[model samples]
Target: MSIIEARSILILILTMPTLTRQGSFGSILSSWSDSNTRGPTISLHAAAKPLMRFMYHRQVLAFIKKNRDTPLSKPIMEIYSSYLAFKHLSPSTKTTILAELDVRIASRADANAVAESLLDYAANLLDSPDANVRISTWRVLAELAHHRSTATAVLAVQPYRRLVELLNHKNVEVLETAVCALAYLTQWPDGAQAAVSPEILSCLVKLLDSPNSGIRRWTCLILGDAAQHQATEMAVSGHLCIGLISLLSESDSEVVENATYALSWITYSSHGVEATLNADILDVIPALLKSPTPQVRRWTCRIIGHIALHKSRASILRLNPCSMLVSFLSDVNVQLRESAIYALSWLTQWPEGAQAAVTAKVLQYLPALLQYRKPHVTKWLRRMLKHLAQHEAMALAAFRTQLVPLVRLGTLVVSSMQGRYSALTKFLMWQTKARLWIPWRGEMGREVNDVFTGMFGGRKRRENGALIPRTS
Candidate 1:
């Protein structure tokens, strides 16, 4: 039968009673099989093609519905095998089949075997002349890359070059899906190494300029995952750093987020840090720090922290991001707060940064962070406070602003301050001694110094017009 005849039969089957429909469908299949006993003929195969496609589609749909809540039975492999044998499934049918496979791979433990079974066939379809087939195939490959076992299986087949080549497809949908597949595939170091050729890197850099935000976003994701490996990190450093920095100004939040995330990972290498600094990333940081997206702000802080590792303190200090970073210490997101504190810890390692931290009133928020039970928060907080304490001016600022809370917690140990006493205790004793002796200065200055010197084994000095504790 032709497609029109097949459709009429399908309508008749649907209009019949359920039992009658089954019997009629079985009879049609039986008649088709009986016809096969004769010599194969063009008319017979042409008539059966659409009928066979419809039958397989119904069987796959029914199988998916029945097994929605359960593991796929072994029969699914047979159904999938027979389904793949049809070389001319419509785009819609191909999409539905691939989508079901994607869902199954994502939700079912046993689906890895199914995915592995389909890997070669799916890889072959990546080059299908039809855009829909290629797009659907890219999506299934992307989903497969999500699982470690299937991801390795996908890598074993080596589709990275084809994925990279598809990035040049004229269709934006194909380009987006191709980039997405690369994004997931590059999550593995080996996969990243395979996918990130010089040509592909150049393509991704150019894609950063794409008007489609999704293309840019997935490109950033690919670069970000590629940057995790040291080899790819260095490879991506100078070439892609500038493109990524430009994306920081993107109107789309997710594009900005992935760009920032990619930059953060890129900054892990010294070469990446150098390239980012050369690209003038500092000028964009203050704006990124104020982004409404918490992830953008968090990763921007991380970029600053990593740049600080390269001793780019002067440039960062010139930008004055310390104030903005300090503001995030009070943010409701714990992870952002942690990233801010981490950035401040690195920034405060120098006197300028310490002064900036003090000028930003970081101490005001320090005590509240102490109440957080998370180890990472406490660790970064302590390091930030320690760096702040290294400078006498910042130390005095902390002493004046947070002394009561620090003393109450009893964990505030200013390594720069002398003697066995806590900095707070020593500062308090010295303050009291000064106040008591001021009235009798002419007669008791030396004697009072000697008294406190013997008691605490240290003395106080006026440095830059600020009282600083001196070690004996």
Candidate 2:
């Protein structure tokens, strides 16, 4: 018997004696019934005290009232009686119960017995030949997969293979639900291990072109989740990255957001980065910059950041994201401006990247970014320009113009007002501000330091009052 059946019988069985004391078993049964047809006769083995039985009856009535308003609650209760009364409830009635169970599972506030019974029976329904049954089964299992505790609980009996098989279901609802269920499974590590296979991943990629915006969005999310792990990322990198990039042009703004998210994770790894570059994903950035939605622009910057990991600034330069991203730095949205700064920071870290920034006309708008008040953006922009100034070309460009002197004045005023400025801090600030010494860190810094050493007689000489080269 299902939990629903057992629970109803338990309620009626426990309350029987109280009714029995009033009259015969027939009268007891009649009182329990609607005075229409006879109710199920469940025999109870133990007897309880009169007061205890009354409380049990009250508890059962309270349970009935609590669930009465839900659409399927009546039939869920009536079904047990229907089975005892030996009547066939239509498929629609059962489906309604399944839908309600879905909501309960989603909210994590399920009736324990009902959920347990559904999990037990849902696997069998996957083979029920009826699409509705399969759809309900998928929905229930998907709901269970939504949470880690329930996902682990149901993993053993979750019909992992059957869920993947439904990806090919002719019914759109079944296919959508199947992909969504599998996507939710990917949230848990074990589920990701089970769901991410060569065949299944290829199937997921196929859904990217599903014409249905919902299907494309869910497919992107599923691939995105699996790609979080290195093993899965290495598995799906090449074709999956290509598929996600192609979706950047999708008319649906949300679809583009999810696709961008997927691309970001997929390309986060060195291997993934290599695969993405091999696929020439840089080709897509120029077009994405044209998207009307700022979110698309925001995520596009993130995607570029991940692809920048290989540190192939030249590869990035060929597509010229420097000018494009610089344009976003002035956007009113703080996030967009930050993303732009972050993307530029990566490109500016190396000499070739810094040169690319200059070549892309970043200097033309370099002064505008200083007006942005977000701390991180300002910091990244400073570092980016610091790296760019190391090229000397950028130094000459800024020093010859009004940019450097104004920035130096601002820094000195802030430092003076803050009351914490020191000799070393002032020297370092002036050096960075004028792009004189690159701070003795990386090859670029060391190279610039070497040049300063040659020009100034020695590094120590500058500390003794021999000033850095005159920008004039």
Question: Which structure among the candidates has the greatest lDDT?
Answer: 1
Tens digits of per-residue lDDT for model 2 on 101-215?
6766645545343444555555566776567867886787788878766787667675777876788766688789988888888887777777678778878878888978898
* Model 2 segments more than 4 A misplaced: 1-90, 111-121, 154-156, 355-386, 389-472
Tens digits of per-residue lDDT, candidate 1, 384-447, equal 7666655656655675567545544644444444322334433333324444333124323444
Tell me the deviation in Å of residue 182 in model 1. Answer: 1.4
lDDT (0-100) at residue 63 of candidate 2?
48
In candidate 2 the C-alpha lDDT for residue 97 amounts to: 54
TM per candidate comes to 0.73, 0.63
Global Cα RMSD, each model: 15.1, 15.7
Per-candidate clashes come to: 0, 0
Q: Could you give me the TM-score of model 2 versus the true structure?
A: 0.63
Candidate 2 residue 228 C-alpha distance from true site, Å: 2.2
